[model samples]
Each structure stands twice: as structure tokens, then as C-alpha cells.
Target: MSTDLSLFGVVNAGSSSLKFAIYEAESCLLSGQVEGIGVRPGSKARDAAGQPIPAPDVTRQPPATPAEALLMLLPWLRDRLGGRTVSALGHRVVHGGPQHARPERVTPALLEQLTVFESLAPLHQPHNLAPIRAVLERMPQLPQVACFDTAFHRSMPEVAQAFALPYAMTERGLRRYGFHGLSYEYIAGRLPELAPDIAAGRVIVAHLGNGASLCALQGGRSVATTMGFSALEGLPMGTRCGELDPAVVLFLLERGMSPAEIQDLLYRRSGMLGLSGLSSDFRDLLASPEPRARFALEVFVYRVARSVGSLAAALGGLDGLVFTAGVGENAAPVRAAVCEACRWLGVELDSEANAVHGPRISRPGSRAAAYVLPTDENLMIARHTRALVAT
Candidate 1:
């Protein structure tokens, strides 16, 4: 007989931070902590609600490595969980390449397979793999699962996933594979509970965080998404340049810059931080008087609005718009700008309602409903982990 596991742990390890959550069966039992493992200089911790949190006592230096961060967080999690034993662990892996479409139990072979896709998601994959390796060393017997961010977008049409590359290159895995799948999955799961009418129709979810992307959902499945091939293809983010001309990359290479240097410039030195030269945080940019900050904000909004229109077209019509993640849940101005840009698509933003943070932020008579639904990707991971283990 299979043992019934009751608790599961989910971890999302980013380039600089680790976000964790614990679930009892399929329900989230507690919101987890964010441990700044390898944060850049001048970064600060914020509560899950986006309020500032006191930083843990650590030497003031460059960000701690992912392993060091996980070492610190494990103890904290143990204390908060009161010695609770999670039967399984789920990880949010950023790239699954062409093969993975669902959660899989982590093994040496699987890890080796995943390593091949590391170049496809250089900024996140290594960091994501670090904690899993650490946990494996610590708990040799514990079952671990990997849930890919690209998995949910697997249902995207062939035309949407492909580029006009040669068959040989395409076969080698050059194609769109959207990120933020767990977040989109969680939102899709909650739709029946939140808005049955819209959930049954066409839906677009905007996952706006340090890394942002939009997904088009029809009948509760992904039809298309903004991020293509790499996370760097969609919306401009905290540090990454979203989309650029192929010729730009060639030009940079021709300037004697190595591929690694070009990658760093595109992934770490661009986006809001590069454009603003002040801050990557939307709140910080909003507070700044610099014209560059204003320009960055405009660029972000413009890309988001443009993507919304494109995704809507992919869905044929827009039924609902879901705003999620960090900025999507809290940044009123960003949402306002996006809604204004989408006004032609029947979005009517309720200013006062939006300011107050409504799950339903659209006017009653608006043709397309707008909402602010907080996403819990970790919870989704935990659920998938539990299900896979139970079977």
C-alpha cells in the first residue's frame, strides 16, 4: 500500500532569492520566507505583502551564494515549520527544453538532462538547481520533484511555439517556452472559485514580477504567451532586456564582446535597472525624479500593453485580465497604465477600486473584466508534487 503523504514543500530559487511555501496535501498551510542568498548590492527584503522586512543578520558584502542562502533558510524553515516533516519537495525549474511537460521526480539522470538546457535559461537554471542539490545532500532519502515553468505553455499551438529557423536548428530546440507556468497554473486553478463565467471563456493572465510574462488561456488552458524561447523574450524585467533585434546580438558579438559578456549585458544590465540607472524596483523608480526612471516605466507599460493586445488576438477575444505577482498585485500605476493602453479592447479601469486593491478592479459595465489575483506558484508546485508522489 502507498503511504499517504500529508505535507509537501515547494521552493522557487531565483538568481538572488529563494521563495518557499509549505502545503498540507493540496492546500497551502503557510506562506514561506524569501531568503536573499545572492542579492546584489543595495537590495532589501520585502514581506510577502511587499512591505519592507528587517534583513537577517549577515555580513554586509556581495550577495551570498545560492547554497549559502539555502543553508540559512533551511534552519529558518525548520523553526517556522515546528519540525514538520514534508513528505516531498517540489522545485520551480525555469526551463524544461523540449521534453518535460509535467512534474518529474528528480534523479541524477534527470539533473544531467536538465543541465543541457542551462544555456537556454542561464540567469535562473543554475540557481534553481543549487538548492535541489543541497537538499539532496542533506536528505538523501527524501523524494524531490521538479516542476518546469515552461510546462504550462506546452499546449501552445505549433505556430506560436516555432520560429522561422531551419528545421535542423529548430529540432535542436530553438522555440518559445513560456515561463511563470506555475503562477499561471495557480491562477487558472483559482479561476473556477473566483470567476466561473470568465474562467469558462477566454482569459489573459499578466504575471508581473521581477520577471514578467503574459499568458493567454482559453477554457482554462494556455493558448499563447509572451515569453518565447527564453525568459528574455517577453516583457522588460528587473534586469533583463525583454526582446531585441537578432542583428543587435550579432553587432555586439562583432564588437569583440564574448557571448558570455553579451549575455550578461542583456540579462543583468538591461531592463528597468539598465534603463533607469536608478533602481529595478518599481517602487523605487516611482519615487525617483530621474527622467530615465520615467522612461523605463513608460517602456515597461508600452511592452505590457502591446503584449496584452497580441495575446488577446491569440485568444480571439479577451474575457478576463488577471494581474498577478509582485508589481501586478501592488503597483497601481503600472496596472493603470496597462489598462489605459488596453482601453481599446473594452477594459474600463475603476480607479478608486484599483487603488483599494480589488480582486475585481474593472467597472461593472466593462466588456472585459480586470482583476488583481495574487499568484502562489509554490502552492501549485506543492500540489503537483503531492499528486505525483501519491500516484
Candidate 2:
């Protein structure tokens, strides 16, 4: 666990991809992912300087299962490590339920307990745990850590985490549990260095991408967030419907739509894709002149701006607003529109700064500052693993 010689490996396994990074203490040496794991499989990587790390011929062997995918990834990772050894492995687990409030060491009992959460996050939980199990089988003594995406939001007040459901249902775990916690946690940790004035004040971070959410950070801790119960709530994402009325499900059922069909409609076929009738990619929609595409973009900005107000209200007021993730960090137009819509909150857009993707985009003296800070969940997981394993 000596920082001088030990390397830490971080894994973020998604439904269709496996992202990995190597860190020497606090510095990342390499990072990459294997995309389209089961279909049209391909892999790519880069070093700390952003130089492409060439893939070996063995990576061309497409993995048929999650275990197979890990098998393909490990050898490539080993060859890239030069001569150093990875002291411990950290994984990004999407849901930690109510009990796991922080990162914990990976164990068979923990894996079995985490499996019970798959029903709550059918698209992610299983995939996130697969590689951990595979590694445990292959290297039983290699210390592994499981970091929760819901762990950061455990700081939210009781009322914010509650639902209006019956007391019995509430007791049965039917309540709000925010997601994208790892990303938010990273942003929160960086605020002191990046925006010291408001680091301990009320701030709202918009994590926009194909899957989006807004988090309200008060004094560097989560007080509320847009995503609740599941990632499908809050902001309108690339393909997922952000917020919906439960009655709509009953209405669809009355019309003969099965629960499965409705679930697919809300989680996949809706959002910007359903609105634009074009694509789930913001880059694609931004370039298209189609009316539906423009409308989709409009809806996305409107929801994000509205959510900022809601989170601000939760914090009693707003001191700063931050944009992160794919759409938030790169899409200048989206940031422009969102900031403009949130002018009531005292955000003044600096077109020049935004166009260049600023670490700070709001004009000086604005009542509430705005920024575009990139998120690094992998680094956050690595730091947690290093700390836990070192001890």
C-alpha cells in the first residue's frame, strides 16, 4: 500500500461497456474502455497525456459475456502496466441501497447482498458487479473495493429522501434515493480548490449526458438531487423520460400496454429521442435543423433550468451553479440556454467563456456564480480504494 510503488485500478462497468483506469497514488497513468461488449465489440485507451494506447490483437476477440469481457480486459491492462503491480481494484457500483453509506471491501457476502438491488437498477447493478466477481475468482487475494453511486446522497435530509407513499410502503424501501453520487462526490471534493468562495455555500451541479441529473450540494454535502428512486427521474436525458406522472402508467395499462412495454417506453424510447424522432445524441440534435430537434433541445434546457430553481429552494438559496458530464461540459449551446433560463437565479452567461468551455463561465459580480467543471468518477473511486486498502 506504499504510495511510491503501488498502483490502483478503477473499474466502471456499464451495460455495454467496461471502463478502466490506472492511478499511481493520486495521478492517473492510463484510462480507457471496451465498448459494445457483446455486439460490434471494440476497445480503445489513452495515457495520462491523452496519447492513444494501442490495443493488442487479443482485444479483437469479442467477449460474449461479462466474465469473458473482464478476461479480455485484464491481459490488455497487464501488458500496459509496464512492470508495476496494481495494489487494489475499485469498482463503480450504481446502487448501494440504504445500508452501504460508503465504499466497502468486496466480499462474497457483500456481492450476494448487492444482488438484491438488481431489481431496482436492472440495467446497471448486475453489470457493475460482474467484473468484481470475475476478479475475485481469478485473484482471490487482490483487494477490491465497491464504491456506491447512492452513497453521496445519504446526507440528504429526511424530508428530501421521503416519498408521499403510505407509511408501510415507505418502510418497505419505496423512497427517494439519488443516483450519480460518485460524480457529484468528485465535484464536491474539487469545489474547495476550484471555487473556494462558494465551496462551502449552496451549489447546484447539473450532470448532463445521455443520462442526466441535478444535485444540490450545501457546504460540500448533498442535500437534494433531481434523480430519485431511480436514474429515470429529474432532467430529460438523451433517451430517458426525466419525470412522469404515475397515473400515465395506469392509463397505458388500460390501453393494453404491458408493464414491460411501458418500462421500455419510459426508459429507452422516450426523452429527446422520442421528442426529436432523430437521435439520443445532443451533438446530432444540435446540428440538425429539424423542428423536432430544436424542440427537444428546448425541453432539455427548460427542465434543467427549472430543476436548478427547485434545488435552490431546497438549499434556501443558491450561491453557485455548476455544469458537468457530457452535455454540461461540452455543449456550449446547452449551457448558454440553461444559464439564460436561470437568469432569475442571478446567473449571467459569458458567451466567450462558455464557448471555450470555461472552468468559470459566469460574469463577475453575478449573485450566483456558474461554472463548467468536468467530472472524474474514476479518480474518485481510485482515491477511496487507495485510502481503504492502505489502512
Which candidate's lDDT is highest? 2
Q: TM-scores for all candidates?
A: 0.90, 0.96
Kindly report which residue stretches of model 2 are placed more than 4 angstroms away from their true locations once superposed: 1-5, 58-60
* Candidate 1 runs further than 4 Å off: 1-4, 26-31, 34-64, 68-83
Evaluated against the true structure, the overall lDDT of model 2 is 0.89
- Residue 186 Cα positional deviation in candidate 2, in Å, after optimal superposition: 0.9
Cα-based lDDT at residue 287, candidate 1: 83
Residue 318 error for model 2, in Å? 1.0
Highest TM-score against the true fold, candidate: 2
RMSD in angstroms between candidate 2 and the native structure over all alpha carbons: 1.9
